[model samples]
Target: MEYVEHRMNDEAVKAAASAGLVSPLNILLLSIILYTGYSTFFAKTSYPQLPKPPPPVVFKTYNPHTLLPFNGENGAPIFFAVRGVVFDVTPGRNFYGPGGPYANFAGRDATRGLACGSFDESMLTKDLDGPLDTLADLGPDEMDALRGWEERFTEKYNIIGKFVSMKDFEELGKKE
Candidate 1:
């Protein structure tokens, strides 16, 4: 009788396995394990995307008087002009600031001064009017020096705008 009962119990367990039957607790546990494994290995974490930068500001023409405010004094930015191009030299504030070595050149075009190697106040104006024809007297060496300064400015600073010429002003008048 004992042997028969033991054989019947083994048969019952085998029948349950062959029929694909399992307890509700076992099914729930297996589902939880599968979900945890998938989340750890296959799930990706989400992150916030960064915004795009704004466009750059551009100035078509810059007048000498308009360029005066950025002289590295009284909380203004330092700017200088070489040739016909305007450059922002705020990075060299110690040299271009007020009372500095090149302070007189802060608000003006210093093309002639740079060419002649003179920091004279008379050589620092942006006026291209009559009786002020200084650049015309410059020799080859002076012109080369001016070119070198222009190249240095182009390499070092940002070219904000170009100097507005008398011809350009006249053309603007014509357009209107």
Candidate 2:
């Protein structure tokens, strides 16, 4: 009786194996486990290392003429002046660079333009060497508008330098 029962169990096992009891999913999982174990403990592959970044550039003061070259022309960085503060607006190149809507203000004092909410060339200072705009004619509302723009610039861009007149810059150089 015992021999008959053992023979029946052996036949059942052979039938199950022939009928594809081990699924395709089980085979795939086993292959993945083997690959993972081999890669983790036996593979000699190494990942490539990334290069380090360059150092930060030192900021320099700029007068209007000196600042003119940084208007996104000839691959130059974009910079602009606002109320005597020179901001490096390179990150906003899309809006302040060449062919941009506010490109006219790049490398120039944008005080009056921003205060008046105009992007016209007429708003910029006509003479680079001339005295800065006093903004004396601006009403309270205009002044408030200018202040808002200045605040946004301060929050968004780097204050690379101060915008001074040529005369003031020369005086500063002489003092140094």
Q: TM-score of the candidate numbered 1?
A: 0.61
lDDT of 2 by residue, 93-164 (tens): 889999999999988999999999999989999898988899999999999999999999999988888899
Report the C-alpha displacement of residue 103, candidate 2, in angstroms: 0.3
Model 1 CA deviation exceeding 4 Å by range:
1-55, 126-134, 173-176
Each model's RMSD to truth, in Å?
A: 6.3, 6.0
Give the top-scoring candidate (TM-score): 2
| TM per prediction | 0.61, 0.72
For model 1 the local lDDT of residue 148 reads 93
Reference-based lDDT, residue 11, model 1: 100
Supply the TM-score for candidate 2: 0.72
Q: How many backbone clashes does candidate 1 have?
A: 0
